[model samples]
Target: VEEAKRAGAKVVVVLATQREADEGRVGRQIADELGVGVVYLHGIQFSGGDEYCEYIKYTLAALVAALEASSGAAGGNGLWPLLILALSIAVVAEAGLLARGWWRGGGRA
Candidate 1:
Protein backbone atom coordinates (compact mmCIF):
# COMPACT_ATOMS: atom_id res chain seq x y z
CA VAL A 1 0.00 0.00 0.00
CA GLU A 2 2.77 2.46 0.81
CA GLU A 3 4.54 1.54 -2.42
CA ALA A 4 1.38 2.08 -4.40
CA LYS A 5 0.95 5.52 -2.84
CA ARG A 6 4.56 6.33 -3.63
CA ALA A 7 3.85 5.42 -7.26
CA GLY A 8 1.08 8.05 -7.32
CA ALA A 9 -1.71 5.55 -7.08
CA LYS A 10 -5.06 5.99 -5.39
CA VAL A 11 -5.87 2.77 -3.60
CA VAL A 12 -9.55 1.93 -3.53
CA VAL A 13 -10.63 -0.99 -1.39
CA VAL A 14 -13.96 -2.59 -2.19
CA LEU A 15 -15.41 -4.31 0.85
CA ALA A 16 -18.61 -6.37 0.57
CA THR A 17 -19.01 -7.20 4.21
CA GLN A 18 -21.60 -5.40 6.30
CA ARG A 19 -19.88 -6.25 9.54
CA GLU A 20 -16.61 -4.80 8.34
CA ALA A 21 -18.45 -1.73 7.19
CA ASP A 22 -19.53 -0.84 10.69
CA GLU A 23 -17.81 1.91 12.59
CA GLY A 24 -14.31 1.16 13.87
CA ARG A 25 -14.03 -2.02 11.77
CA VAL A 26 -10.76 -3.42 10.50
CA GLY A 27 -11.59 -2.58 6.92
CA ARG A 28 -11.97 1.10 7.79
CA GLN A 29 -8.76 1.00 9.73
CA ILE A 30 -6.90 -0.48 6.78
CA ALA A 31 -8.26 2.15 4.44
CA ASP A 32 -7.29 4.87 6.85
CA GLU A 33 -3.80 3.50 7.19
CA LEU A 34 -3.35 3.29 3.42
CA GLY A 35 -5.00 6.66 2.86
CA VAL A 36 -7.38 5.02 0.41
CA GLY A 37 -11.06 5.12 -0.29
CA VAL A 38 -13.33 2.22 0.55
CA VAL A 39 -16.30 1.39 -1.60
CA TYR A 40 -18.93 -0.29 0.51
CA LEU A 41 -21.10 -2.66 -1.45
CA HIS A 42 -23.91 -4.87 -0.20
CA GLY A 43 -25.30 -8.18 -1.40
CA ILE A 44 -22.07 -9.14 -3.10
CA GLN A 45 -22.36 -12.89 -3.52
CA PHE A 46 -19.18 -14.44 -4.94
CA SER A 47 -21.00 -17.59 -6.06
CA GLY A 48 -21.35 -16.34 -9.65
CA GLY A 49 -24.19 -13.85 -9.57
CA ASP A 50 -25.14 -10.50 -11.09
CA GLU A 51 -24.32 -8.48 -7.98
CA TYR A 52 -20.90 -10.09 -7.75
CA CYS A 53 -20.24 -9.41 -11.41
CA GLU A 54 -21.33 -5.80 -11.00
CA TYR A 55 -19.02 -5.38 -8.05
CA ILE A 56 -16.13 -6.71 -10.10
CA LYS A 57 -17.01 -4.35 -12.92
CA TYR A 58 -17.06 -1.34 -10.59
CA THR A 59 -13.76 -2.40 -9.03
CA LEU A 60 -12.16 -2.52 -12.46
CA ALA A 61 -13.60 0.86 -13.30
CA ALA A 62 -12.22 2.35 -10.09
CA LEU A 63 -8.80 0.90 -10.81
CA VAL A 64 -8.82 2.34 -14.30
CA ALA A 65 -9.80 5.76 -12.98
CA ALA A 66 -7.05 5.68 -10.39
CA LEU A 67 -4.41 4.67 -12.93
CA GLU A 68 -5.57 7.22 -15.43
CA ALA A 69 -5.46 9.89 -12.77
CA SER A 70 -1.78 9.21 -12.09
CA SER A 71 -0.97 10.93 -15.39
CA GLY A 72 -1.90 14.30 -13.81
CA ALA A 73 -4.17 15.10 -16.75
CA ALA A 74 -7.58 16.49 -15.96
CA GLY A 75 -10.58 14.79 -17.52
CA GLY A 76 -12.83 16.77 -19.83
CA ASN A 77 -15.98 16.18 -17.82
CA GLY A 78 -15.76 17.61 -14.32
CA LEU A 79 -18.33 17.40 -11.49
CA TRP A 80 -21.27 18.52 -13.64
CA PRO A 81 -22.68 15.05 -13.94
CA LEU A 82 -22.50 14.42 -10.21
CA LEU A 83 -23.86 17.87 -9.39
CA ILE A 84 -26.78 17.42 -11.75
CA LEU A 85 -27.55 14.01 -10.32
CA ALA A 86 -27.52 15.40 -6.78
CA LEU A 87 -29.70 18.33 -7.77
CA SER A 88 -32.22 16.04 -9.44
CA ILE A 89 -32.52 13.88 -6.35
CA ALA A 90 -32.86 16.92 -4.11
CA VAL A 91 -35.65 18.34 -6.29
CA VAL A 92 -37.55 15.06 -6.25
CA ALA A 93 -37.19 14.77 -2.48
CA GLU A 94 -38.34 18.36 -1.93
CA ALA A 95 -41.37 17.76 -4.13
CA GLY A 96 -42.26 14.63 -2.20
CA LEU A 97 -41.93 16.43 1.13
CA LEU A 98 -44.01 19.38 -0.02
CA ALA A 99 -46.72 17.12 -1.45
CA ARG A 100 -46.91 15.14 1.74
CA GLY A 101 -47.12 18.27 3.91
CA TRP A 102 -49.78 19.87 1.70
CA TRP A 103 -51.82 16.71 1.58
CA ARG A 104 -51.79 16.36 5.33
CA GLY A 105 -52.64 20.03 6.02
CA GLY A 106 -55.13 20.54 3.16
CA GLY A 107 -52.94 22.79 1.00
CA ARG A 108 -51.28 25.27 3.40
CA ALA A 109 -47.67 26.39 3.95
Candidate 2:
Protein backbone atom coordinates (compact mmCIF):
# COMPACT_ATOMS: atom_id res chain seq x y z
CA VAL A 1 0.00 0.00 0.00
CA GLU A 2 2.76 2.45 0.89
CA GLU A 3 4.54 1.37 -2.28
CA ALA A 4 1.39 2.08 -4.26
CA LYS A 5 1.29 5.57 -2.81
CA ARG A 6 4.91 6.11 -3.69
CA ALA A 7 4.14 4.90 -7.18
CA GLY A 8 1.43 7.63 -7.48
CA ALA A 9 -1.66 5.49 -7.44
CA LYS A 10 -4.83 7.57 -7.02
CA VAL A 11 -7.24 5.10 -5.43
CA VAL A 12 -7.22 1.95 -3.38
CA VAL A 13 -9.69 -0.90 -2.89
CA VAL A 14 -9.61 -3.04 0.23
CA LEU A 15 -11.28 -6.42 0.42
CA ALA A 16 -11.43 -7.34 4.07
CA THR A 17 -12.23 -10.48 6.02
CA GLN A 18 -14.69 -10.63 8.91
CA ARG A 19 -11.95 -10.64 11.53
CA GLU A 20 -10.20 -7.74 9.86
CA ALA A 21 -13.53 -5.96 9.63
CA ASP A 22 -13.91 -6.25 13.40
CA GLU A 23 -10.35 -5.53 14.41
CA GLY A 24 -9.96 -1.78 14.31
CA ARG A 25 -12.06 -1.46 11.20
CA VAL A 26 -8.97 -1.97 9.07
CA GLY A 27 -10.44 -0.97 5.74
CA ARG A 28 -11.68 2.41 6.89
CA GLN A 29 -8.49 3.02 8.87
CA ILE A 30 -6.35 2.24 5.86
CA ALA A 31 -8.39 4.58 3.71
CA ASP A 32 -8.08 7.35 6.28
CA GLU A 33 -4.38 6.82 6.71
CA LEU A 34 -3.80 6.79 2.96
CA GLY A 35 -5.95 9.87 2.40
CA VAL A 36 -7.09 8.51 -0.93
CA GLY A 37 -10.34 7.29 -2.43
CA VAL A 38 -11.26 3.82 -1.17
CA VAL A 39 -13.86 1.23 -1.96
CA TYR A 40 -14.54 -1.13 0.92
CA LEU A 41 -16.67 -4.22 0.38
CA HIS A 42 -17.49 -5.69 3.73
CA GLY A 43 -19.99 -7.97 5.54
CA ILE A 44 -19.36 -10.80 3.11
CA GLN A 45 -20.09 -13.63 5.53
CA PHE A 46 -23.73 -14.07 4.61
CA SER A 47 -22.99 -14.43 0.93
CA GLY A 48 -23.09 -17.87 -0.74
CA GLY A 49 -20.74 -19.31 -3.33
CA ASP A 50 -22.94 -18.29 -6.21
CA GLU A 51 -23.29 -14.81 -4.75
CA TYR A 52 -19.54 -14.48 -4.47
CA CYS A 53 -19.11 -15.62 -8.06
CA GLU A 54 -21.70 -13.12 -9.21
CA TYR A 55 -20.00 -10.40 -7.20
CA ILE A 56 -16.68 -11.18 -8.86
CA LYS A 57 -18.29 -11.11 -12.27
CA TYR A 58 -19.92 -7.76 -11.53
CA THR A 59 -16.65 -6.35 -10.25
CA LEU A 60 -14.83 -7.48 -13.35
CA ALA A 61 -17.43 -5.91 -15.59
CA ALA A 62 -17.18 -2.65 -13.67
CA LEU A 63 -13.39 -2.70 -13.95
CA VAL A 64 -13.59 -3.41 -17.65
CA ALA A 65 -15.92 -0.49 -18.15
CA ALA A 66 -13.67 1.81 -16.16
CA LEU A 67 -10.57 0.75 -18.06
CA GLU A 68 -12.27 1.16 -21.39
CA ALA A 69 -13.53 4.59 -20.44
CA SER A 70 -10.09 5.65 -19.29
CA SER A 71 -8.27 4.46 -22.41
CA GLY A 72 -9.52 7.33 -24.59
CA ALA A 73 -12.38 9.66 -25.39
CA ALA A 74 -12.96 8.22 -28.85
CA GLY A 75 -15.91 6.25 -27.45
CA GLY A 76 -14.33 3.00 -28.61
CA ASN A 77 -16.68 0.28 -29.82
CA GLY A 78 -14.39 -2.44 -28.49
CA LEU A 79 -15.74 -2.39 -24.96
CA TRP A 80 -19.37 -2.79 -25.92
CA PRO A 81 -18.57 -5.87 -27.95
CA LEU A 82 -16.55 -7.32 -25.09
CA LEU A 83 -19.31 -6.51 -22.61
CA ILE A 84 -21.90 -8.20 -24.79
CA LEU A 85 -19.76 -11.30 -25.15
CA ALA A 86 -19.15 -11.51 -21.42
CA LEU A 87 -22.82 -11.11 -20.59
CA SER A 88 -23.78 -13.76 -23.10
CA ILE A 89 -21.25 -16.16 -21.64
CA ALA A 90 -22.46 -15.53 -18.12
CA VAL A 91 -26.05 -16.05 -19.11
CA VAL A 92 -25.32 -19.30 -20.89
CA ALA A 93 -23.21 -20.61 -18.02
CA GLU A 94 -25.89 -19.75 -15.49
CA ALA A 95 -28.54 -21.45 -17.58
CA GLY A 96 -26.44 -24.57 -17.87
CA LEU A 97 -25.84 -24.63 -14.12
CA LEU A 98 -29.54 -24.30 -13.45
CA ALA A 99 -30.34 -27.10 -15.86
CA ARG A 100 -27.73 -29.37 -14.30
CA GLY A 101 -29.01 -28.65 -10.82
CA TRP A 102 -32.56 -29.38 -11.84
CA TRP A 103 -31.50 -32.65 -13.43
CA ARG A 104 -29.71 -33.61 -10.21
CA GLY A 105 -32.92 -33.34 -8.14
CA GLY A 106 -32.24 -29.82 -6.93
CA GLY A 107 -35.86 -28.96 -7.56
CA ARG A 108 -36.95 -31.51 -4.95
CA ALA A 109 -35.66 -29.21 -2.23
Candidate 3:
Protein backbone atom coordinates (compact mmCIF):
# COMPACT_ATOMS: atom_id res chain seq x y z
CA VAL A 1 0.00 0.00 0.00
CA GLU A 2 2.76 2.43 0.89
CA GLU A 3 4.63 1.53 -2.27
CA ALA A 4 1.50 1.95 -4.37
CA LYS A 5 0.81 5.32 -2.79
CA ARG A 6 4.40 6.30 -3.44
CA ALA A 7 3.89 5.32 -7.06
CA GLY A 8 1.04 7.86 -7.38
CA ALA A 9 -1.81 5.38 -7.04
CA LYS A 10 -4.90 6.12 -4.95
CA VAL A 11 -4.96 3.87 -1.88
CA VAL A 12 -8.06 2.60 -0.08
CA VAL A 13 -7.82 0.49 3.04
CA VAL A 14 -10.82 -1.58 4.18
CA LEU A 15 -11.01 -2.65 7.81
CA ALA A 16 -12.85 -5.98 8.10
CA THR A 17 -13.37 -6.28 11.88
CA GLN A 18 -14.84 -3.99 14.52
CA ARG A 19 -11.57 -3.84 16.36
CA GLU A 20 -9.71 -3.17 13.18
CA ALA A 21 -12.19 -0.51 12.30
CA ASP A 22 -11.96 1.09 15.71
CA GLU A 23 -8.21 1.12 15.77
CA GLY A 24 -6.93 0.49 12.24
CA ARG A 25 -3.92 1.81 13.99
CA VAL A 26 -1.30 1.28 11.30
CA GLY A 27 -3.70 1.41 8.36
CA ARG A 28 -5.52 4.52 9.51
CA GLN A 29 -2.31 6.16 10.51
CA ILE A 30 -0.72 5.53 7.15
CA ALA A 31 -3.87 6.57 5.33
CA ASP A 32 -3.98 9.83 7.24
CA GLU A 33 -0.30 10.41 6.73
CA LEU A 34 -0.60 9.77 2.99
CA GLY A 35 -3.98 11.44 2.43
CA VAL A 36 -5.67 8.20 1.37
CA GLY A 37 -9.14 6.79 2.02
CA VAL A 38 -10.16 4.23 4.65
CA VAL A 39 -13.43 2.34 4.89
CA TYR A 40 -14.80 0.28 7.81
CA LEU A 41 -16.88 -2.80 6.98
CA HIS A 42 -17.01 -4.36 10.44
CA GLY A 43 -18.97 -7.52 9.59
CA ILE A 44 -18.74 -7.95 5.86
CA GLN A 45 -15.80 -10.31 6.10
CA PHE A 46 -17.28 -12.70 8.66
CA SER A 47 -20.94 -12.49 7.80
CA GLY A 48 -22.54 -13.94 4.66
CA GLY A 49 -19.58 -12.88 2.51
CA ASP A 50 -22.17 -11.56 0.05
CA GLU A 51 -22.12 -8.45 2.21
CA TYR A 52 -18.53 -8.01 1.21
CA CYS A 53 -19.61 -7.38 -2.36
CA GLU A 54 -22.04 -4.68 -1.32
CA TYR A 55 -19.50 -3.11 0.99
CA ILE A 56 -16.93 -3.24 -1.80
CA LYS A 57 -19.24 -1.21 -4.02
CA TYR A 58 -19.77 1.31 -1.27
CA THR A 59 -16.07 1.46 -0.53
CA LEU A 60 -15.21 2.11 -4.17
CA ALA A 61 -17.77 4.85 -4.51
CA ALA A 62 -16.59 6.51 -1.31
CA LEU A 63 -13.00 6.31 -2.44
CA VAL A 64 -13.87 7.89 -5.78
CA ALA A 65 -15.79 10.67 -4.06
CA ALA A 66 -12.97 11.29 -1.66
CA LEU A 67 -10.39 11.40 -4.44
CA GLU A 68 -12.54 13.69 -6.54
CA ALA A 69 -13.19 16.01 -3.61
CA SER A 70 -9.52 16.07 -2.76
CA SER A 71 -8.66 16.91 -6.37
CA GLY A 72 -11.11 19.89 -6.34
CA ALA A 73 -13.43 18.39 -8.96
CA ALA A 74 -16.33 17.99 -6.55
CA GLY A 75 -15.63 21.51 -5.21
CA GLY A 76 -16.33 23.01 -8.68
CA ASN A 77 -12.82 24.41 -8.96
CA GLY A 78 -11.74 21.84 -11.53
CA LEU A 79 -12.26 21.68 -15.32
CA TRP A 80 -14.58 18.64 -15.08
CA PRO A 81 -17.69 20.31 -16.47
CA LEU A 82 -15.80 21.94 -19.30
CA LEU A 83 -14.25 18.67 -20.29
CA ILE A 84 -17.59 16.87 -20.17
CA LEU A 85 -19.23 19.54 -22.29
CA ALA A 86 -16.42 19.42 -24.82
CA LEU A 87 -16.76 15.65 -25.10
CA SER A 88 -20.51 15.93 -25.51
CA ILE A 89 -20.09 18.45 -28.30
CA ALA A 90 -17.54 16.27 -30.02
CA VAL A 91 -19.85 13.24 -29.87
CA VAL A 92 -22.75 15.23 -31.26
CA ALA A 93 -20.65 16.53 -34.13
CA GLU A 94 -19.42 13.04 -34.96
CA ALA A 95 -22.94 11.63 -34.93
CA GLY A 96 -24.14 14.43 -37.26
CA LEU A 97 -21.32 13.72 -39.68
CA LEU A 98 -22.08 10.02 -39.68
CA ALA A 99 -25.77 10.68 -40.32
CA ARG A 100 -24.96 12.96 -43.23
CA GLY A 101 -22.69 10.33 -44.77
CA TRP A 102 -25.36 7.67 -44.36
CA TRP A 103 -27.99 9.86 -46.02
CA ARG A 104 -25.64 10.60 -48.91
CA GLY A 105 -25.16 6.86 -49.38
CA GLY A 106 -28.97 6.34 -49.55
CA GLY A 107 -28.92 4.77 -46.08
CA ARG A 108 -27.21 1.67 -47.43
CA ALA A 109 -24.38 -0.19 -45.73
Candidate 4:
Protein backbone atom coordinates (compact mmCIF):
# COMPACT_ATOMS: atom_id res chain seq x y z
CA VAL A 1 0.00 0.00 0.00
CA GLU A 2 2.74 2.48 0.90
CA GLU A 3 4.73 1.56 -2.20
CA ALA A 4 1.71 2.00 -4.43
CA LYS A 5 0.96 5.36 -2.86
CA ARG A 6 4.58 6.43 -3.32
CA ALA A 7 4.29 5.53 -7.00
CA GLY A 8 1.38 8.05 -7.36
CA ALA A 9 -1.33 5.48 -7.06
CA LYS A 10 -4.56 6.35 -5.27
CA VAL A 11 -4.83 3.39 -2.93
CA VAL A 12 -8.04 2.02 -1.49
CA VAL A 13 -7.96 -0.90 0.93
CA VAL A 14 -10.66 -3.48 0.46
CA LEU A 15 -11.47 -6.15 3.03
CA ALA A 16 -13.13 -9.36 1.85
CA THR A 17 -14.82 -10.08 5.15
CA GLN A 18 -15.04 -8.83 8.71
CA ARG A 19 -16.10 -12.16 10.15
CA GLU A 20 -12.65 -13.23 11.26
CA ALA A 21 -12.03 -14.08 14.89
CA ASP A 22 -9.96 -10.90 15.03
CA GLU A 23 -12.94 -9.14 13.42
CA GLY A 24 -10.87 -7.68 10.57
CA ARG A 25 -8.70 -5.79 12.98
CA VAL A 26 -5.61 -6.27 10.83
CA GLY A 27 -7.09 -4.81 7.67
CA ARG A 28 -8.69 -1.96 9.59
CA GLN A 29 -5.40 -1.22 11.33
CA ILE A 30 -3.51 -1.02 8.03
CA ALA A 31 -6.10 1.19 6.46
CA ASP A 32 -6.09 3.46 9.50
CA GLU A 33 -2.32 3.69 9.54
CA LEU A 34 -2.23 4.56 5.84
CA GLY A 35 -5.27 6.87 5.98
CA VAL A 36 -6.81 5.24 2.92
CA GLY A 37 -10.34 4.50 1.86
CA VAL A 38 -11.44 1.05 3.06
CA VAL A 39 -14.40 -0.87 1.76
CA TYR A 40 -15.76 -3.77 3.79
CA LEU A 41 -17.61 -6.28 1.64
CA HIS A 42 -19.16 -8.05 4.63
CA GLY A 43 -20.89 -11.32 3.60
CA ILE A 44 -20.39 -10.81 -0.11
CA GLN A 45 -17.31 -13.02 0.00
CA PHE A 46 -19.58 -16.07 0.33
CA SER A 47 -21.86 -14.99 -2.49
CA GLY A 48 -21.88 -16.06 -6.12
CA GLY A 49 -19.94 -14.60 -9.03
CA ASP A 50 -22.80 -12.27 -9.86
CA GLU A 51 -22.51 -10.70 -6.42
CA TYR A 52 -18.80 -10.19 -6.98
CA CYS A 53 -19.52 -8.34 -10.21
CA GLU A 54 -22.06 -6.16 -8.43
CA TYR A 55 -19.48 -5.45 -5.77
CA ILE A 56 -17.03 -4.28 -8.40
CA LYS A 57 -19.59 -1.96 -9.95
CA TYR A 58 -20.63 -0.40 -6.64
CA THR A 59 -17.05 -0.14 -5.40
CA LEU A 60 -16.03 1.78 -8.50
CA ALA A 61 -18.95 4.12 -8.07
CA ALA A 62 -18.05 4.68 -4.43
CA LEU A 63 -14.43 5.36 -5.32
CA VAL A 64 -15.44 7.94 -7.91
CA ALA A 65 -17.75 9.65 -5.42
CA ALA A 66 -15.04 9.75 -2.78
CA LEU A 67 -12.55 11.27 -5.21
CA GLU A 68 -15.03 13.88 -6.35
CA ALA A 69 -15.90 14.82 -2.77
CA SER A 70 -12.25 15.10 -1.79
CA SER A 71 -11.46 17.26 -4.81
CA GLY A 72 -14.43 19.49 -4.07
CA ALA A 73 -13.23 19.98 -0.50
CA ALA A 74 -9.65 20.74 -1.63
CA GLY A 75 -10.40 24.01 -3.48
CA GLY A 76 -12.63 26.08 -5.68
CA ASN A 77 -14.15 23.44 -7.97
CA GLY A 78 -17.53 22.98 -9.67
CA LEU A 79 -18.82 20.75 -6.89
CA TRP A 80 -19.95 23.53 -4.60
CA PRO A 81 -21.46 25.34 -7.56
CA LEU A 82 -23.32 22.25 -8.65
CA LEU A 83 -24.51 21.58 -5.09
CA ILE A 84 -25.81 25.13 -4.75
CA LEU A 85 -27.63 24.83 -8.06
CA ALA A 86 -29.24 21.60 -6.96
CA LEU A 87 -30.32 23.12 -3.65
CA SER A 88 -31.77 26.15 -5.41
CA ILE A 89 -33.77 23.94 -7.73
CA ALA A 90 -35.06 21.89 -4.80
CA VAL A 91 -36.12 25.02 -2.91
CA VAL A 92 -37.94 26.36 -5.94
CA ALA A 93 -39.76 23.09 -6.41
CA GLU A 94 -40.74 22.96 -2.75
CA ALA A 95 -42.05 26.53 -2.87
CA GLY A 96 -44.11 25.70 -5.97
CA LEU A 97 -45.62 22.71 -4.21
CA LEU A 98 -46.43 24.72 -1.12
CA ALA A 99 -48.05 27.47 -3.19
CA ARG A 100 -50.22 24.95 -5.01
CA GLY A 101 -51.29 23.37 -1.71
CA TRP A 102 -52.09 26.75 -0.19
CA TRP A 103 -54.06 27.79 -3.23
CA ARG A 104 -56.07 24.60 -3.03
CA GLY A 105 -56.78 25.34 0.62
CA GLY A 106 -58.27 28.75 -0.31
CA GLY A 107 -55.27 30.68 1.05
CA ARG A 108 -55.85 29.30 4.56
CA ALA A 109 -52.92 28.22 6.77
Predictions: Cα RMSD each: 12.3, 6.1, 11.3, 12.2
Tens digit of lDDT per residue, candidate 1, span 32-89? 7776655554445455654433454554455445544533456654534544554566
lDDT of 2 by residue, 7-103 (tens): 7544445654443554436655665666654444444433654454476467657655544544454556466777777777777777777777788
Against the reference, the lDDT scores of all candidates come to 0.55, 0.58, 0.58, 0.55
Q: Write the per-residue lDDT of candidate 4 for residues 2-46, one digit (tens) a residue.
A: 775575433344545553535466666665666654555434534
| Model 2 stretches with alpha carbons more than 4 Å out | 1-46, 49-53, 106-109
TM-score of each candidate structure, all chains considered together: 0.38, 0.47, 0.40, 0.38
Summed over model 1, clashes come to 0
Model 4 scores worst on lDDT over the 10 consecutive residues at: 8-17
Instruction: Summarize candidate 3's per-residue lDDT along 9-53 as a digit string, tens digits.
Output: 445455556335445777677677778665544434445654434
Question: Over all chains combined, what TM-score does candidate 3 have?
Answer: 0.40
Model 2, position 82: C-alpha lDDT score: 74
lDDT of 2: 0.58
The C-alpha stretches of model 3 lying farther than 4 A from their native spots are: 16-23, 41-56, 75-109
Write down the lDDT that model 1 would get. Answer: 0.55
Indicate the residue-level lDDT of 64 in model 4.
50
